[model samples]
Target: TEMFESDNVDLKKQMQTYNGLDHPFSIGDELLVENSQFLLKMKTDMPNVVVFTFNDTSSWKSDMNIYKAHSGFTLEAQNLPNDINLLGKDAPSILQKDQAFYSRTTYQIIEKLL
Candidate 1:
């Protein structure tokens, strides 16, 4: 049971009685616990709530962190290898950018987990 303060808003205030966090939760809707780090995995259940699984890289405990319902950030789903290529020459650069974004975000997750 942890609560974090962000933008003067109390994240997890609604989480006190909900025990749904144990299993996979929603994506994009979760607050990043003020100062925590989480490695993004993939998306599940589009539109309603694009949930993404995350790895708690900073933790020695080897636990998975699922960030559900994150609506504020401009997080685009990573294009799968099998997906159609729409970017033409920009594909390589876009993938590289995504990699960098995930890497940096994972680092931030590590800081929060510690």
Candidate 2:
């Protein structure tokens, strides 16, 4: 997550500098932010999971955009909760170089009749 935050800050700073020079920001170098907290909570037993992330745009406020990305899966009931604190500690180390850890698990889903 630190990697994402640092990248976001750097991108915003670059955009600010560009704006100051009367230049337009390009989408090619845009940063994609993720909801690390919500992502870390998804379990394998759940039918689906939704993660929400916010963008860093203090540098430029004319445009505030929110994007939603989704994925579908079925849980097998053997998944467990992850230790988010430990993951946060490792964020710095992971961000130093351009890399990320991808984990997977199954969640139990309950059906509700309306």
Candidate 3:
């Protein structure tokens, strides 16, 4: 199980807040903030893994509270697309790969003034 990792500097120590219904934001919400860092990881299945940190992105325009917005991150596992051929065809099933073998990537989220 190959592994990959990345980090954001300015976002190391910050806070984030989100609001909405029980479901909140969807998979691709395009989060925004002043200066924040995110850490994304790609496990056995590249598409199935997502890791990110949100800092200082909440507002009173909606519901929720400070506790919910104060420092939050997520490590989500999803399903990879069927068309993606990561292993050159000869590779074994994703389940067969060792748990330690994983890949990751990191990025940052910035608020764009529209």
> Which stretches in model 1 have alpha-carbon errors above 4 Å?
1-10, 19-38, 50-114
Task: Sort every candidate by TM-score, greatest first.
Answer: 3, 1, 2
Cα-based lDDT at residue 111, candidate 2 = 39
lDDT of 2 by residue, 29-105 (tens): 12232252333222432222322222233544455534321122222222112323456654322334556644455
lDDT tens readout by residue for model 1, 8-55: 232343233231121222344232333235553433322222222221
- Candidate 1's TM-score reads 0.20
Model 1: number of clashes? 17
lDDT of 1 at 8: 27
Q: What C-alpha RMSD separates each model from the true structure?
A: 13.1, 16.4, 14.6
Better of 1 and 2 by TM-score: 1
Whichever of 2 and 3 has more lDDT, that candidate is 3
Q: Could you tell which candidate, 2 or 3, scores higher by TM-score? A: 3
Better of 1 and 3 by lDDT: 3
Clashes of each: 17, 7, 12
